[model samples]
Target: MKITIAYIEEPPFGWTGRDQAAMGADIELADVVLRAIGVSTIHHHLTSFDELLPGIQEGRWDMNVPLFVTPERAQRVAFSVPVWSIGDGFLLHCGNPKVLTSYEAVAARSDARLGIIAGQVQFESAKSAGVLDRQIVLFKDQPDAISALRAGMIDAYASTAVGNRVLAESADNAALEAVAHNNGGDGRVPIGAFSFNKSNHDLIKAVNKRLIEYLGSADHRARMERYGLTHTEIDGAIISQSAKY
Candidate 1:
């Protein structure tokens, strides 16, 4: 059957907007993998990260692509074996400006403005950390937040580790730098797989099996590196943690 893939339309992932043309690492990886298994005719596009959960919960879409299998989310949806592990951390403007490092550091500063993704787990993390509701500026999506960051509207941004590399490297802002989590950043955030309904167990298992094959291949590592995944252990954690399955 044709898979209607739902993903957040953003760079180094997949998005169809001005400036950015088509698929990124995740988009291409998903398409290639699914088609290899004879699931051709992929209709892929972007959806807000929050909207994916709502849409899938309501059956508005068949899958949420490039997903990370969080225990909380896994309890409600069927997730394929992870296809990628995305590490995330802080992205700050070029230069050692402010010498910013950790979220707590940003929080301690009264002048700091944090750019966060609304309805995302990171937002919850910030909230749990007591990020003042006012100090936290919520954006509709990642790219929107990045734009604000480049404009110097925000002090620093909490972002996926890979996102930091891409924005710093490819994005217009060449000065952006990704400070690894150990330097007071969150070690990494994992991103992979799609969330299918529990009824799609067959699909889920098939995807997992394919993941085993894919991950073992050198090509997969190349793909991950392209997307900014440096932590190999994340791949193991993604599958092992799914024991809750």
Candidate 2:
């Protein structure tokens, strides 16, 4: 059998590498799980982030992996039990003068402008933390958002912790840093999951069963670490699934 998976660019989760191959922890994991379930051929389709859900709904793709699940999204697509939970963070100048590490901090400032990729959980989280829509400056992708932050066009760039870390570590960005979101409480930690067309109930179940097995393995741990995820984070994510959701 064969399957087509759609995704947008988000490092450590999913992206088109320099060689134009779909590569990331989530992409590789999906490949492994699909092959294990007798999917001999897998196709990766790159779509605009804004199009992922609508594309899935229209059957433009068989599925979408690397979506950060929320109640709103779950209502639209069938989500497999989350592979892990991760939170948003900020990529800021070296000094982080405004200390915009968490959404709450940005929300607290009337003058603060935060750059976020359009249609991402970071945008949702910012709103949840009381950020007004006017204060948000949506960019088309991470590079654009990062550029805005670097050029002082935005106070900070909001995105995933792993993504920010990867960006800040780049040679050209030596003056920036990645700061994890810790707002004195659980402030909008999103569970990451693959989304399937709502009608693919059997396929969702099959993938979820295989995913759970894969998540429990040492191979998963190594794959995650390669993308800068800490063991504690994934472990807590698994436990939180049962405890909170």
CA-RMSD of model 1: 3.1
Per-model TM-score, in order, reads 0.84, 0.92
Span of ten consecutive residues with least summed lDDT in model 2: 182-191
User: Best candidate, lDDT-wise?
Assistant: 2
List the candidate 1 regions with Cα displacement exceeding 4 Å. 17-21, 183-191, 231-245
What are the root-mean-square deviations of the candidates from the true structure over C-alphas? 3.1, 2.0
Clashes of each: 5, 0
Task: Please give, for residues 60-161, the per-residue lDDT of candidate 2 as tens digits.
Answer: 888897678778888888888778777668888998898786788888998899998888878877899999999999998776887788889998888877
Question: What tens-digit string does per-residue lDDT give for candidate 1 at 24-63?
Answer: 7667767767776779677774678878877777777767
Residue 57 in model 2: lDDT: 89
Q: What is the lDDT of residue 131 in candidate 1?
A: 69
Candidate 1, which ten residues in sequence have the lowest lDDT sum?
180-189
Please give the CA lDDT of all the candidate structures: 0.69, 0.83
